[model samples]
Target chain A: MAAHMTNAHRRFLQVLMSNRITEGSEARKLHQHCCETDKVYYAHDKLDDFISTINSHLQPLFMQIRKGISEDDGRAHYAVVNLAETEVTKMASDYTEMELELFRKTMDLIILSENGFASSTDILNLADQLKTKKMKKKEAEQVLKVFVEDKWLSEKNGEYTLHTRCIIEMEQYILSYYQDLAKKCNLCHSLAIQSQVCESCGIGMHLPCARKYFRGQTEPRCPKCNEFWSCDTPGVNRMGSQT
Target chain B: GKEKANELHSEMSAFDSTAFAEDLLTFMGINRTEVEETNDSEDVPADFLPSHAWQKMGEEALKYFRRAPTFHYMMGSFKSESPVRKQRIE
Candidate 1:
């Protein structure tokens, strides 16, 4: 059964399968292997591929991998988390009203902004927009801690970015509950928060551009996805309706 | 819950990309210990179970992983009661 494996892959399998088997020698071997991989993979031209390989192998096992540098240690690190034991699994659904309020502010900073990373100060400053009596910087700091520690957000050098876990686990909620105010126009190449969206294919176009595109079509369709774009909505025929 | 977890275990256990990951590790002359997890926790909640479609996705993801190493961009649905991503009810 192990005939197909190269010696290295077999060694890795031995390390993975060791937890169920024995203690002392296996532990030493596992540590040795981890260090070898760290030196070779992290420092080589294979950085991205090495990360990908680890992720692909463990994803089926329900392991979540993250890259971070702890502020306390200031050393870069990679972590593997068990999804079943992780509090991050349903954290979005478990948000308190206050947490959700802060999440809204975070959305404005990360998703609605030109760049994805938002400084700690930006998150704290957005607290002013909250309807609550006072949104002090201390409160934002605490909320950011919750977000980072719980793995909902990934922080680097005091700038926070969305994690892949959040994207995968919260796909539907984000698509349905929130509008992408930062969508860039395909034609004009600028943010088009108010663009009409195609429900079938989920693309956006400026209403004026859509109107011009659909001018002569008896059955208008999205140029990108070829999905039917209905013109029946309010005053869709108003281009020549004044006549 | 037990049934869904079992189903997930069955689905997940069918594909092993560790060989491919290890191949890349070997190619880089990195003799890493296999840190790949082998099983999902039996206590996984029903709500946390992936959609029924994940079985197929697992196969596809494995296929992609075997050809190359990047599977991070592959998406799996976690929507509750979503039409295309309905979780196994039973």
Candidate 2:
């Protein structure tokens, strides 16, 4: 039988529902706060177990509290997922048909690109081409801003990539949909959107994972083929440098 | 024992459904008195009874709450193009 849900679990679920996603450190803090406030047993190392208890209750409702590591930084994150809905209907309630079309096109650009990013200009150009309803450049820009604010996408230097939460939730869907096109990181074995592709073998590894693997080596070599790893070693302080 | 059962029934009756319904209407930002007055004045259908209307509102609220998207669900929603988004223009 699953662990019984307590006031602490309910409190945590409430906060998570409102925030949608929380980073590892923040989740831990929230875990501690919930336990203390509810006068439940609190343990620093028991956050995962605490979440599992909540997940058991949510299973009947077709929801789950999922944990995943960020491809950009390798930091852990928690997001609530809906297991019942699929594809368009999942988001149709919040976004219009045109907006959904734009977002899908944006995903195509990012996922199919070598660097797993779509430039702002490229994404903006698709707005007018949307099949459902053409969106003006200004309208598309506003929608893009909303996407970022809602944490569906993250932007850097005017380039857009899927948010960590998106990757966590859609990993299986993306893998199945993209088939050979979407590559998984050989190291972590998870979907790698922002990754370095091996020139000879075509295997991919997330930048953070590659950094960790090649940290002390004199010359980085492909773990699979043992060939020279050609990509520039991402700097320690550059992206998700924290161990 | 018979007196105790009667006392329980009286206590239960003291909890007024109309008062509770008015409180719910106020919380939901609906003016129950205005609705009641309109129903009283107009040839409103039986379906427009205050209790029925509030019950409908409650069902709608439940639907909205249940459909509220989680962060993961919200992001996963944009994969409409599926295998690939077609090239719109050459």
Top TM-score model: 2
Error of 1 at A98 (Å): 1.2
Candidate topping lDDT:
2
Taking chain B only, the TM-score of every model is 0.19, 0.26
- Return the clash pairs for model 1, or none: none
DockQ of each: 0.01, 0.11
Residue A70 lDDT (model 2): 89
What is the per-residue lDDT of model 1 for residues A74-133, given as tens digits with 9 covering 90 to 100? 233343444442333433344555556676567557755444567888888877666544
Give the range of the ten consecutive residues with the poorest summed lDDT in model 1 chain B.
B70-79
In candidate 1, stretches whose alpha carbon ends up further than 4 angstroms from where it belongs are: A1-95, A179-243, B1-90
TM-score of chain A of 2: 0.92
Candidate 1 on B31-69: residue-level lDDT in tens?
A: 344343553654643222224445644665666663422
